[model samples]
Target: MKLKRDFYLQDCVKVARDLLGKVFVHETKEGIAKGIIVETEAYNGAIDKASHSYKYKRTKRTEIQFGLGGYAYVYFIYGMHFNINIVTGIEGEPQGVLIRGIQPTYGIDLMKERRKTDNLINLTNGPAKLCQAMGITKEQYGMDLCNSNLYIEEGISIEDKDVDITKRINIDYAAEDKDRLWRFSIKDNPFVSIKVKS
Candidate 1:
């Protein structure tokens, strides 16, 4: 079943951690592609230095974050890749969870075609990679997650013992907030992005 908006209205950290093992589905004109969420990172707006809306800053790129929870915050990065994030928290609060990794569960052939590879690790191992493999683009920005073509759904239940927590990746620029343990992954999940440093 599709997750309700209330599921994303809670704390960003909670939603990020709980998102592991859920199914992320994206339906496009080409076909339906789905994957089990294996990794995520939480960004608490205003207070989170790593967030685009940090200090409550609102720009055209971040305006959607301040809207109601359960929306897609798709954005282009590095001038080439697109990353998909789920907006969370109440309207104007601007918290979001980055979907870092997913384990392909449906439309594997379609994902491989889009990614141009059959290697499981290369399928949807990172946020940008998953967006590409799942045919998600910046056009999906602001799409409501609660009831939209792209949404998360119930999948296998992940146990606490099967989870691993670590600092987020590629955001050392956040300074002191860089070390915060906001990244969560399913323990031993090969599809998870990268191994957390010890």
Candidate 2:
């Protein structure tokens, strides 16, 4: 079933922790693509130096980040890739969590069509790649995951023992914040770009 608004209304930390076992699904005109959410990174709003919306600074690009919870906050990075994040926390709060990886559960052919390659291992292994496979883009920004075309769903249950936590990768710039250990993922999930010890 599609996850509800309340599912994402909680704080980023709780949302990040609970997201490990959920399934993220994208239904497109081409086909249906799905993945069990195997990894995620949280960015606390304002107070967090790691958050782009830190200090609640609103830009044309970040306006949606300040909207009600359950909205998508997709943005382009490196002038080439799109990173998908779900806006979390209460209204006016800009916290979000990046969905870093997923284990593909459907539409392999469709993923291949979009990616134009045959290497299944390379298909949805990272954030940008997964967004491409699922047809997510800036047009999808601010979409309500609870009722939009793109939404998260309940999937295979994972035991608490099977989930792991660690500091998020690629943000050593956050210094002491780098050690917050806010990243969460399923242990040994094949789609995860990084391996984690449980």
Candidate 3:
């Protein structure tokens, strides 16, 4: 079953952790690809220094986050890679959950071809890489995940013992927020972007 809007209308930190073990599906014109979410990072809006919408800054790229939850916040980074985040919280709250990694379960050939790699471990090990392999891009920005082609589905039930909480990656500039331990990933999941202790 597809996750509902209410499923995303909660605290970002909770949503990020809950998203693990769920299925992330992106049905594109090329084909449909599915994967099990294994990693995620949460950014608390308005107050979080790591968030683009910190202080309620509403630029073109960040305005989507200020809307109701259950939307896809796709953004371009490094002028090359596209990263996807799930908008969370109520209107104007602007919280987000970044899907950092997934293990491909369907359309493996399409994912491998998109990534130009035959190594299964390298297919969707990172945020941008998973986006590429799944054919997700800026075009998917602000998509309503509750009803759109891009959405998460109910899959495996994740237990507390199977998850590891850690600090986000490469956001040391967020001051104390860098150590907030907002990142969540399945323990021992080889598809995770980074390995860190809880």
Candidate 4:
């Protein structure tokens, strides 16, 4: 079953941990592709120092991040790659979780077509890469995940022992914040991208 609307960031930590084994499904004209969420990173509210809303300020790019939870806050960085984030925390509090990686469960051929490479190694391993593979874009910003064309679903139930937690990737610029250690993932999901340099 798909996640219920009531599952929005009521408890950010629990939500992050629970997402470890959930299946995230995205449907497009190309086809339906599903992945088991194997990795994630959480950003807490304005005071968390690691969140984009740290100053409690809003910009065209961050407005959606400050709104309701469970919405998509897709954005572009490094000029080309789209990074997909799921808004979390209480409304107006402005926190979100970055989906870092997933294990492909459906439409492997379609993912290969969009990525232009049959190498599963590069398929849906990182955030920006997954967005490309799934056809998500900035146009999806603020779209409600609970009801949008692209949404997360509860596919396979995993035991707590199967999930893993570690420091997030690619935030060395955050300094002391780098030690916050908030990344979560499945212990051994093959679809996760490991060759990419963070």
Candidate 5:
């Protein structure tokens, strides 16, 4: 079943952890592709220094975050790749979960073709890599996952014991927020970009 807005309306940390093992699907004219979410990181935009909308600072790129939850907060990072985040919390309060990794589950041929690689482990193993393999782009920014071509649905249930919580990656400038153990990943998942980082 496709996850409802209620799933995203909860605490971002909880949503990040709960998102493990869910099937994220994107349907396009090219075809439908699916992946099992293996890693995620949560950012509380209100006070979290790591958040783009830190202190609720809204810019052209961050304004979408201030809207209701269950929307895609796709952004271009480092001027090269796109990273997709699932907005969380209420209409006014901005929060989001970054999808760090996914295990390709459908349309393998397409993923391989887009990534220009046949190595299964290399495809959709990182945030930007997954977006490329799944055909997600800046056009998907602010797309509501509740009723859009891109949305997460039910998948294999992941137990708490099977998940590992660790600090987020590549955000050393977030000060104390960088140490927060908000990154959740399915334990021993080969498709995960990185393992638990202590």
Candidate 6:
């Protein structure tokens, strides 16, 4: 079943952790690409220095983040790759969960072709990589995940023992907020973007 808007209306941290093992599907003109979510990172609005909407700072690029939950907040980074984020929280709240990694389950050839590689791990092991592999782009921004071609679906249940929490990656500029354990991943999942250090 596709997740409803209500599923993303709660705390972003909760939504991030719960997203594990769910199937993220993107239907494009090329084909349908689907994968099991393996990693995610929650960014709380205003309070989270690492968040784009921190301090309630609004900009053209961040407008979608302030919209109602269950919307896509896709953005381009490094002047090339697009990062796909699921908008969470109430309207004007500006919270989001970044989908970091996925294990491809369908359209493997399509994903490999899009990513220009056949190696499974290199296909969708990171946010930008997953976006490319799934054919997601800025055009998808503000697209409602509750009723869209790109949406999450019910998949395998992940137990507590399978979850690993850690600080978000590549946001050192956030200072103290960088240490918060907001990143969640499926423990021992080969598809997870980064291996957690013991």
lDDT against true structure, model 6: 0.93
The TM-score of candidate 1 is 0.98
Worst 10 residues of 1 by lDDT: 189-198
Query: Which sections of candidate 1 miss by over 4 Å?
Result: none
TM-score per candidate, chains pooled: 0.98, 0.95, 0.98, 0.92, 0.98, 0.98
| Candidate 1, position 190, lDDT | 89
Question: Superposing all C-alpha atoms, what RMSD in Å does each candidate have to the true structure?
Answer: 0.8, 1.5, 0.8, 2.3, 0.7, 0.9
Per-residue lDDT of candidate 6, residues 85-151 (tens digit): 9999898898999999999999999999999998988899999999999999888988999888999
Which wins on lDDT, candidate 1 or candidate 5? 5
Give the local distance difference test score of model 4. 0.79
Question: After superposing candidate 4, which stretches have Cα over 4 Å from the reference?
Answer: 194-198
lDDT of each: 0.93, 0.86, 0.94, 0.79, 0.94, 0.93
Which residue pairs come into collision in candidate 1?
none
| Candidate 6: 10-residue stretch with minimal lDDT | 189-198
**Candidate 3 versus the native: TM-score?**
0.98
30 in model 2: Cα distance from truth in Å? 1.4
C-alpha lDDT (0 to 100) for residue 152 of candidate 3: 93
* Per-residue accuracy of model 3 over 1-198 as CA lDDT, tens digit each: 999989999999999999999999999888999999999999987789999998888999998999999999999999999999999999999899999999999999999999999999999999999999999988999999998999999999889999999989989799988889899999999999888765
Give one digit per residue, the lDDT tens place, for model 1 in 1-198.
999989989889999999998999999999999999999999998798999999999999999999888999999999999998999889889899999999999999999999999898889999999999999998899999887899999999999999999999999899999999999999999899899863
Q: Against the correct fold, how does model 2 do in TM-score?
A: 0.95
Error of 6 at 122 (Å): 1.1
Give per-candidate clash totals. Answer: 0, 1, 0, 0, 0, 0
Backbone clash tally (model 6): 0
